[model samples]
Target: MVSRVLVPMDDSETAGRALRYALDVHSDAEITVYHVVGSPSMMMGSAVGLALEDDIETAATERAKPVFDRAHEVAAEYDTEIETQVGLGHPTRAIVARADDYDAIVMGCHGEHSENITRGFLVGNVAKTVFERSPIPVTTVR
Candidate 1:
């Protein structure tokens, strides 16, 4: 009897599929879509803008908009609305840190940038780490 399900999303096809899977499989549960913005980096990245913003929370929200929009579109297909949350720093840590608040976690097998050699090395496998570290059940969709 899972009453709450968390779906961590990125602007990736597999993330979208995980959202759909959660909606279809956990219809009775309250669904929350989470997007993590990279933490402020000295090198090149979106977080550099976050570091400069006077209102860092607002900046993070703005950065998460595209992914959240896609989540909304997916929810629309099921005639449901989803709550959204934004987090800072690494995806795996952000997601796993929040996992205790929900009954389960649903996410993509890997993120959009996981295929990129450079980012893959830098980010590692977010879903794998989240699955291993999460306090709740984790379901991964392809």
Candidate 2:
């Protein structure tokens, strides 16, 4: 039984679809919708722009809040319990680390590949990383 399901969402429509699919398949479970704030290492900033790095990270986290809020609203249709969280680090690693805490993970394999979700993980780097490292079951959505 899937006691909890976690999905790492972006602002993409694919993520929206994945979350919806997760809800339908795992109804009545507690779901955690998470968004990983990109770490400074991922940013290509010059020495001058580095001064605003902290602010940029804060801004990124703040911007993800509303998208997760929408995810919360979407969870209501399935009569599921939902929680939202934001983390800072490599997206795939962070998600996989927490995957063990949840029974399964439901996510969009392709961040933006609308035509092919089957090969989504291969083409999409983050999904590939999570797929390789996830300790639990992974359901990839288009």
Quick one: best lDDT, which candidate?
1
Off by over 4 Å in 2: 45-60, 112-123
Query: Which candidate leads the pack in TM-score?
Result: 1
Worst 10 residues of 1 by lDDT: 115-124
Clashes of each: 0, 0
TM-score of predicted structure 2: 0.78
lDDT of 2: 0.75
Tens digits of per-residue lDDT, candidate 1, 1-142, equal 9999999998878899999999999999999999999987767476788788888889999999999999998899999989999999988888998988999999988787874543435233888898788899999887
The global C-alpha lDDT for each of the candidates, from Candidate 1 onward, is: 0.88, 0.75
Q: Which stretches of candidate 1 lie over 4 Å from their true place?
A: 118-124
Angstrom error at residue 142, model 1: 0.7
TM-score of each candidate? 0.91, 0.78
